[model samples]
Target chain A: MGVSVALVITMLELVGLFTFATSGALLAIQKGFDAVGILVLAILTALGGGILRDLIIGDTPPAAFTDVMYLVVPVVAAAVTFFAHPLLQRWTFTVLIFDAAGLGLFCVTGTLKALRFDLGPLQAVLLGVMTAVGGGVLRDITARETPALVQADSSLYAIPAALGSAGVVGAYHAGLPLGIVGTAAAVFVFGLRVVAMVRHWRAPRAWTRRRPEVGR
Target chain B: MGVSVALVITMLELVGLFTFATSGALLAIQKGFDAVGILVLAILTALGGGILRDLIIGDTPPAAFTDVMYLVVPVVAAAVTFFAHPLLQRWTFTVLIFDAAGLGLFCVTGTLKALRFDLGPLQAVLLGVMTAVGGGVLRDITARETPALVQADSSLYAIPAALGSAGVVGAYHAGLPLGIVGTAAAVFVFGLRVVAMVRHWRAPRAWTRRRPEVGR
Candidate 1:
């Protein structure tokens, strides 16, 4: 039962990968990238976080190498966008919805992977956050734009991912039903993030005029 | 003696960081970046790899937050480049030399850190290679170009860094003086890389045609 649940989650995560890849390719197009650049950005946006996660866990070759679907999905998404960009640009809100789904799936998947590696809860949560944001971070860096997660005064994107991961792990330790508990956690995170975005909720900034003292 | 040797290496690494930061700032200027972009590129080029290394190792806040010099050097380098870029552009070769030195330092430092954390030889070497090339990889992605490391035909950048790091670790285990052996290893790597660049030497590519058997 747990294996089946994990499989379903993995499948959803792949869907998320494709969505993110399309978004990346669209951004590349907006930036006047040629075909090659669009393809590269798509691949990076899809696989970059997973690659980082696997490398940190000492997994050789990485899942991006082993899974044929992972590679095919991104390439196909980029090619589709290349051909249908004129039509797709009309559905901008739809793309953001897909991007949000990808974010949620990746956050949970990353947390689960970290836990499987026997990392502590804090480390697991951090890994989850990194996995959720890493691809977008790579995308922004590639586009030479300030990473929205870091620079924008927006609701806590990483914080919610961390919270969701912690919740799932907590429920798992408490011997809850895997599918029900995991789904609940994911929905909670996704819904909270949507609310935050809609309401324009943001993390408080402790703005100060005084320079903080530095320790040697 | 060990402390003094580490300090000296750290100082040299700072110099290299400064040079790379200046180069990054100049690139930003050529790309028509404003002040924030210049600072972003400068810091990213200088400290990006070390930050990634620390994050992968599950170190919080990273070394950039711990060391004042690490933060200061890049900013100072950016300011210098902002004011002196016209003159510096004439000395491109000199800047490249400094960049090479920084690359050597980062590779060795990364390898040593991995070994200290009790990772095996292969893992240590991989970490060393990533640490050396990771920043530049980010830089290229930011610039929307193919990473020099992964391009089909490029100079032997990562290979030498890996070999040099492995050599240093191997020599250390064989009971060589740490300072002398390490410095020699760095110089060997730097010289080999320079030769490769000058001679346009590169790793041989394997030809693959599109075929069903090729598993595309």
Candidate 2:
């Protein structure tokens, strides 16, 4: 709530937004989408989660649409990716690192926002994870690709976000200073996500079970 | 609004929800998803559009979550699909008819809700179309299918919703009685959608354009 703390949160949010936008734009370029599609995907990827969060919490118009800076950042990020994607292709891992950072930061902030809205702890955690991963899900769906969220082959995504959000909720309930605790939680999620990617970690599929072709 | 009008709207909404839920559940069963997956898809498809509409307009918690009847309708629809899907499979065209009816009803209701929230006419129309088609989009994405909204091969879907929404918006601004105009619009949308489906109408894709492998 303090000015300095708010400023730090804002800075982190911008970084998260930028990373998400870049990821979306790069994907659009790779998919052979047009310029308009690239811009739309980038903006949606950056702002979709927050917009979803605000809407669920009864926040009207959503902060992303209201704030000029929030809108501008994604456009700039898209432009950067649109022109320089070939050059940026070599740094795929670097983009993934930034995307992980965004996922981490979003989970913490989203959880805090839900708590502020007086949602129950469990609901807050759910919303936090949604806020972290929802945008990428939207991007993939729009591009007609299978979302990594539900793909067994994809590296761990939602688990890190859930852990980050759970940690934030715990710290908040424990009366810890959010400025420090929140940052720590984000770093933890970021590290976990990066490690999962490096190690090619995956979520487990359901165990094989017998079932009749018809009802039980 | 009068009590009778409210009752009619609620009835129509339930019908819409049931149809959407049936569609989702059928898709899940076809995809060989488990019982839980069927229920999840059914509920999400039934409620997703209204939830999106409510969130966008800052109506928190969403009516779908708050109203027990709304929740109950979808569950019943899913149950019907799960237990009697073989019987229901014979009525695939019948289900599509019901889905078109739902689409028609939702566009009118969604536009009216947006207008109530003081959105501009254009914005209201956009929301209306979103409300009508949003649930189906979510169902398709969750099932990892291409959304018909963007698929050129698919029959006209969002188009009917747009037309219905636009009519509602125009009638409202012209001070026409919504009860009458809204119903008329819904009927028009339903007719158009069924015709499109039967005739195999499709949206046009972009024309061929020369481009480098990289950016223009």
Candidate 3:
């Protein structure tokens, strides 16, 4: 049962990888990165977090090396964006959904990997959060823009991933069915993100004081 | 004695950080990254490896947070490069030396950290190698270039760091004087790199058959 669920999750993760790669490539182009930059961003967005996670876990010959599909997916995604850029721009929502799916899958995969490494729950959740957003963070930085995570106040990006990771871990510990639990966790994260986008729900920000008035 | 040696190495690492950050920032400007991109590259080159090292060791908050100097050095380096790029370009050799220093320091520091976590010698050495070169790999990919490590015809970059790390660990186990051992390791790695650069020494490539002969 766990094996089947893991396989399903991996498949979803691949789709997510492709989507995320395309989004990264498009963003690089939008930011005026050259063709080389676009390809680089695409691959980085798809592979960076996994590489970091694997390295931390002492997993040699990282996932990108062992899996031909992982390598192929991002390249094909980048090529599609390169050729169909006009259509992609016209259909921005298509990319956004893919990005969302990718985000959900990565968060789950990252959380699971951390748990497999026997990390504490909080650490597992944090790793999940990092995995979900790390690629986008790398993409923005490479393109030389303020990271969307820091700049986009309206997105509850990290929160949803954190919650999903926690839910999966919690359910597993509580003896919940893996398939039901994993699917529910993914759906919860995906739903929350979509809702946050549509409703413009945002994390609360602290107001900054300007030139504090003489020890008021 | 060990503490003093570590402090000296850390100080050199900071200097190296400043130099590498400046190089990254200069490259960003050359690529026409706005202020944001330049700063991102600068920070990545400065903190990327250390951050990876800390994370692998499960060090919460990472070194970047513990050492305010780490943060300050990269920002200052970026600012200097932003303003004095023309002068920096002429001092490329100086920059390379600084980068080499950072690489050597990280190689040692990463190895020590891995040992502290009780990893085997091979694992510790591998971690050191990863920590030394990981940032540059990330930076190159982000900048849309091939990682120097994977370049087919490049001289030995990571190999020297690996050898240096092994030397340090071996010295520690062999009851050698700590200060002399570390200094020797650093100087050996740095001198080897300098020689390689001057001599254009490269790793031997495997020979491949240009054409297939008919089966006997």
TM-scores, chain A, per candidate: 0.88, 0.92, 0.90
Candidate 3 C-alpha error for residue A214, in Å: 49
Error of 1 at A61 (Å): 17
* Candidate 2 wrongly placed segments (more than 4 Å): A89-95, A207-216, B1-43, B56-58, B63-134, B146-216
Ranking by DockQ: 2, 1, 3
Which residue pairs in candidate 1 have backbone atoms (N, alpha carbon, C) closer than 3 angstroms, thus clashing?
Answer: A141-B142, A142-B141
Deviation in Å, model 1, residue A203 alpha carbon:
30
lDDT of 1 by residue, A83-135 (tens): 77767544445555555666777778887788778888888888877777788
Q: What tens-digit string does per-residue lDDT give for candidate 3 at B117-171?
A: 7878898898887777877776665665566677655667788999999997887
Consecutive 10-residue window with the lowest summed lDDT within model 3 chain A:
A207-216
Give each candidate's interface RMSD in Å: 12.6, 7.6, 14.5
Question: Tens digit of lDDT per residue, candidate 1, span B29-74?
Answer: 8778899989998888888887777666556577778989989999
TM-score attained by model 1:
0.56
- Report the error of model 3 at residue A139, Å: 6.0
RMSD of 3: 11.8
Supply candidate 1's per-residue lDDT for A114.
83
lDDT of 2 by residue, B19-108 (tens): 889888776665555554566578778888999898778788677745667778987998888777766544557657767887998898
Every candidate's DockQ is 0.05, 0.13, 0.04
Chain B TM-score against the true chain B, candidate 1: 0.87
User: Would you give me the overall lDDT of model 1?
Assistant: 0.71
